[model samples]
Target chain A: MTADPRDLVVRGLTKRYANGALANDRIDLHVHAGEVFGLLGPNGAGKTTLVKQIIGLLKPSAGSITLGREDFVANPDTARALCAYLPQGALPLSSFRLQEVVELVGRIRGGDAPAVRRRVDHLIAALELDEWRDTAGIELSGGTRRLAGFLMAAVWPAALVILDEPTNDVDPLRRRLLWRLIRQLAEDGSSVLLVTHNVLEAEQSVDRLAVIDKGRIVAMGTPSSLKAGDRQSLRLQLSLVPGVDPPAPPPFAHRPIRLGQRWHLGIDQSDAPEAIRWAQDRMAAGVAEEYVLGATTIEDLYIRLIGREDALDRAS
Target chain B: MNLFTRWLRSYGLMVTWELRSLRTVLPLAFVVQTMISSGLILGLGFLMHDITATQAQFLAVGVTVVSMITLGMVMAPQLIASQKQSGAYEYLLSLPVPRTTLIAAGLTVHSLIALPGAAVALLIAWLRYDIALSVSPIVIPAALLTLTTAASIGFALAHAIPNPMVTSLVTNVLIFVILFYAPINFPADRLPVWLASVHQVLPFGHSANLMRAGLTEGLASSVGVSFAVLGGWALASWSVTAWVVGRRA
Candidate 1:
């Protein structure tokens, strides 16, 4: 097979601390260019450690990491020049103003001050951080600190940008803005890696994702593909007649969920037709209005891939 | 673009941050130290009518030198330990900066805290003894050696110790012990010859001796050996601290 030009190849990457804790086990990951790749895992599952190793913050205990074909271990400065990383809740220096923090990070990453200023100005404006641009980092609100971190990561326009938990502590509106920015980065041909605990958020935003558990990748694919390959589960919303109580009659018994004035059930896709048929038959017998069936959501696929228990465990 | 420039940038940023923090804490420390010394000496000097004008001058200079040593031992280690605790050192390590920059920045900031204490002590001496003070050519090298030595020892202690509070307390005790009971605390003649030999070997004793030799008129001839000892301590301490930092990295 031809070597992929637009990808980072991590082969047998392992990191063992001196105390003998293996933060990252032997693992491999491929992130294609122009595709937003989400690294999903629970806290301490090595998501941050793996990302740090990928970005050259920590050397792997054993393995080779290549960024677009360049050996990162041998020349980390050059490799790092090609990527930007926003560590989890990375703080700007307390003494530095928001604009100074962005400009300094941008400059260190090889952008000129004037050019950095323009880009930083645009990012501040885009993120609605202009009002806080001159405020010192210690004085900013938590969400503003997050905005500063996002600006620092994006201000340089590096080829690959890794953001760890970019949405945590951010308000919903700014989270939407951040998601849009990640999409825009990939659209502009820069690979984006998002490491997060928010599976639903990743599902809505990532072009593809890797679900890592206990230092290993358990699943990797487009969100829909991962969800679809699990034999396609369907969710149905059905309204029961006023006097008809819900019946739990089958082993694939309805997983009760609320949708408007009806009760929803998660069922195997193969059984969806029969289940819908049953629902329709009930409706004819005097069931209420509104019966619908739709493709499985990412949350459903995530549950199946990792198993319901594992998913809930990871989520908790 | 070059390693030197990278080193300079990193070292400059750290030094700026260190100096900013030192400024916030140094003034109160300087005032407290000065007041304590002045009060103690005034109460004691009047009781001892045999204290000569020259001895009074020596006493003031001794207080200042002791203050420098105290600040270096107490303030410097606490600064380093606080940076370690605050995650500042880890943050610095994450950058592309060389390790020597961290050491240099820390030393430079601590040495700066010594400057004002030294100046204030001199002013008190000039007022109390009517002594005309000049920047003697020997004082430059001597003061630089003393400051550099004090800073390196501080760095080494800070690097070796994990806890800031414990380090500061231990350093303060060490500073007091070396500066108070040793022959270096007074004229060398006041000590038994055997104990004087022992006092001369202590790092603070050497620092105090060197400071006295640089400031006093009759002791100018002894400044050369004092400079050499001070320089030797500085070099040794820096190497030790650097090794510790390298191992950490």
Candidate 2:
């Protein structure tokens, strides 16, 4: 079967910087139309570099990026026309009012004036930015400015929307609204590529996700599929009393990781009864504050997939 | 939309954006420029015990050239460097508008900001020194070329350098040289022969010569050579700017 014209297909994408740093190794991925695809990675994992290549800000060393029938690598103008990018940095709207910024971007992208204005109004209301509509960009808080930046891109939806760290610095309430807007865009038939390192959010939000490490894609699939390998494993998290050393790991448990006042350990389903008994005895002896045993989360899987020791060290 | 229509629309929007975004700074910029231009005309007169009509004309015309060059060479680069430091440059490049439109809009806005100062200086010279200028039609192209060339060179410098601090330092040094070291307001022959020879090949001396030709008839020698030289510099500088802006990696 032929692919839809709006699908994004990248094959053998590679980028080697002048300093001999391979920012992106040979990579392949496909994002279908109307899908919310996520690229999850830690800092410096080449997520931004890959997005830059797709949007024509950076040239690939060797790659084929096709959107529908068009070659994005060779035709950058088409890439610009077809994709809308919300960069990781703050938007350059210091002098423009929130409403004006969105309308101007839409018009510049060739949206009809009346239509652009309508969409701008809708986005402002939807994003709960009505009170700040006339406020200049510099006067707004960082999170508000970021929301306005999203409006600037969403007011004129392109074939593909690439948002890098869209939820950074956003409050929980507005973040939910932002995610809803992203879903609405996908429902309206645009592909959304979300780049972030927030593992829990990715697990809940994306239709599919790729975990990148050291310029390579370590894994890619639906959330469930990616976590399938850990289905039989249980996670035991203990909140230890202050000034108490972490307890030793049980025989069936994986290495225990101490994160400040808490310790996290993974164990098999058969070891759950013994793990809980051990936690109870420790709490009774005043060595632990509380304990909870649950299924392994994407965060745990992510740590394990990328080498837990190194990932934990970086996290700390 | 057709290509022309799309370009025209994008260009209009970009110009509006630039003007509105800079509305606050522009007023101060205009005031500073007017002060600089008028200050040079009046302040330099103190150096002459008995100024002649020819000397007054040179000073008057030279100050106007200074005003034009300052906006393009000094102000443009500084503004661009600030934008780079603030991450606006990358955001702008990611937009779908034609890259040329951005350059054109910038030049237009900066040129407009420059004009009132040049005019004010000329008026001051007329009122203070009572100097009469020929004011030939060549002044139009001469002024346009001077501004475009200077602004292009500034844009090239700002984009070519990766560090905003370095670009800012370079522009500051450039303004110092243009104001004190270069033969802009003064006749080139007043400098050492070697320096005068160097000015022949540089754009600064040629820029003043073209403006002088426009402001006073017969004041500028080799008008054709000056135009050719200024035009060449404008072309080369603009080419460099376009290349830097268009490069993707």
Give per-residue lDDT, candidate 1, residue A22: 86
lDDT of each: 0.72, 0.86
lDDT, candidate 1, at B171: 79
Q: Give the clashing pairs for model 2.
A: none
lDDT of 1 by residue, A140-224 (tens): 8777887787777788777788888888678888888878888988888788999987888888899889988778888888887
Best by DockQ: 2
As for candidate 1, its clashing pairs are: none
> How do the candidates score on chain B by TM-score?
0.87, 0.95
How many residue pairs clash per model?
0, 0
Model 1 reaches what TM-score against the true structure? 0.76
Error of 1 at B198 (Å): 6.8
Q: What DockQ do you compute for every candidate structure?
A: 0.18, 0.73
Worst 10 residues of 2 chain B by lDDT: B175-184
For each candidate in turn, the TM-score is 0.76, 0.93
- Prediction 1 global C-alpha lDDT: 0.72
With candidate 1 superimposed using the best TM-score fit, by how many Å does residue A232's alpha carbon deviate from the native?
A: 2.6
